[model samples]
Target: MRKPRWWAELALIAVVYAAYSGGRILVKGGEASAVEHGLAILRFEEGLGIDAEHPLNRLFTSVPALGIPADFAYASLHYLVTPAILVWLFRRRPAHYRAARAWLMTATLLGLVGFTLFPTCPPRLLDAAHGFSDTMAHFSAYGWWGGEASAPRGLGGMTNQYAAMPSLHVGWALWCGVMLWRYGRTPLAKALGVAYPLVTALVVMGTANHYLLDAVAGVAVMGAGPLLAPYVLRLVDRLRETAEASPVVSAGCETSAGERIPGQRSVRTTADDKQEWGLPCSSEAESLGKAR
Candidate 1:
């Protein structure tokens, strides 16, 4: 494994994040369908006798002090913690960062596809008749959020409220936890790795930002991402190999002696180069040929 190109990697991450953000905003239609699906999901949970969001939200709101912190976690940590972990991994564990990043990106893309295909409204968006409380709305004053799920004041409309079926929040949190558990050296690190995702699951449910099934789907997505990573990485490797094999200069750029012309580009001479004009010897040309 070669050293990863930092600039290219950062640029790719930034571009992908922009695409995901823009994608959520662009796929903002079918509210009626989304509402119907959300209701159906709620009913399905009721049928299973595992519908916990209502009780959870009620418990959270019962303690105004706790609700404030939970709201802050739901609104902030979902975005902050994942990237912080990624940067840490990039700096400290470059060997593991590639696979971790690939898995996260894979799950995120799958979540986007879910949003496009099944835009189910979150519990917050459900009607009051359904016994759902907008916990964030109820506790918005204590935090920066303004009654909308994680969106700032007056900018709530920019976000797609219906993109809530498969919660990337839970998925990313779990991914972070998994990475930490597997790679972290200390016991406290491992404990926090397990704790963070569990806390995120509770936060998303308590804040009414996602369904129980949504969090389950998030885990399922993460599971699928690792399975798909091998194929995706192989494709990326093939593309990189193809690009490297292509010529970097014109066919006639170098003469039979394989020496650079004057004023084209400065060629640095190494210690062993004893040629009259500092030209590369036959052995050097052979090594360059093999490298190419």
Candidate 2:
């Protein structure tokens, strides 16, 4: 595979992120429906006895130390660490970068679809009697986020508060974790690979920004990414190949003789083609002609 250029990769990421953000803003599900879906998820989790949001939220809020940092993490790390890891892969593990990047972009687009289809409210937005608190709201004064999700203080209105199902926060953390663990050579990197996702899951739950099911859905989304990424990569390759294979003249005249050569076409031979055909390259052909 050809090595990807940093600028091109950056532009691709920026465009994808802009699309994801714009999709989230546009799919603002109705408040009543969002809450109902949130309740449904809560009931489902409770039936399975995995309703961890309440307890986690209470623990985070009751202690400022835990609550403040968790809020910061919920608001910032989702934006920060993912890109940092992408840069790390580009610089340190170039061979693995393309596949990893494709996987992440595919998963992110999948997340946008989930957000569009299932815009469930977060645990924090449910009824107060549900026993879940919005730790981000509680600790808003300590950080840049406001009463609304993790958007900036006054800019909170710009974000879609109800797009909580299949939390991309957890999904991205899982992606980052996998990249680090798979490509990172050091023990610390592997250890971080395990710890990062677990911590992010806890942070999202503890902050009441996502339900346990949302985190599970996020994991499921990440799982689906790898399976779909190869196809995406292949499609991109085909498009690139098509663009590169522009039409060439089918026949051309020899300037010296001024005669047309039928069935002769102008084609650029790649190194692989020369190897496969066992043919001398242009330079070698020239050297042989001179020797003759």
Task: Write model 2 residue lDDT over 1-292, tens digit each, in one string.
Answer: 7889999999999999999999999999999999999999999999999999888989999999899998988889999999999999999989888999999999989998998898899999888999988888887888887899888889987899999989889999999999889888999999999999999999999999999999999999999999999999999999987776654322231222323346566454455755554443346443443464
**Candidate 2 lDDT score at position 235:** 99
Could you tell me how far off, in angstroms, the CA of residue 45 lies in candidate 1 after the best superposition? 0.4
Candidate 2 C-alpha error for residue 287, in Å:
27
Give the CA lDDT, 0 to 100, for residue 76 in model 2: 91
Candidate 1 per-residue lDDT, tens place, 1-112, comes to: 7777889888989999999999999998688999998999999999999889889888888888778889999888988999889888999999998988898998899999
Worst lDDT run of 10 residues, candidate 2, spans 249-258
TM-score of 1: 0.86
Residue pair clashes in candidate 1: none
TM-score per candidate: 0.86, 0.86
- After superposition, the stretches of candidate 2 with alpha carbons farther than 4 Å from their true spots are 248-292
Q: All candidates' lDDT scores?
A: 0.85, 0.87
Which runs in model 1 stand beyond 4 Å of their true positions? 248-292
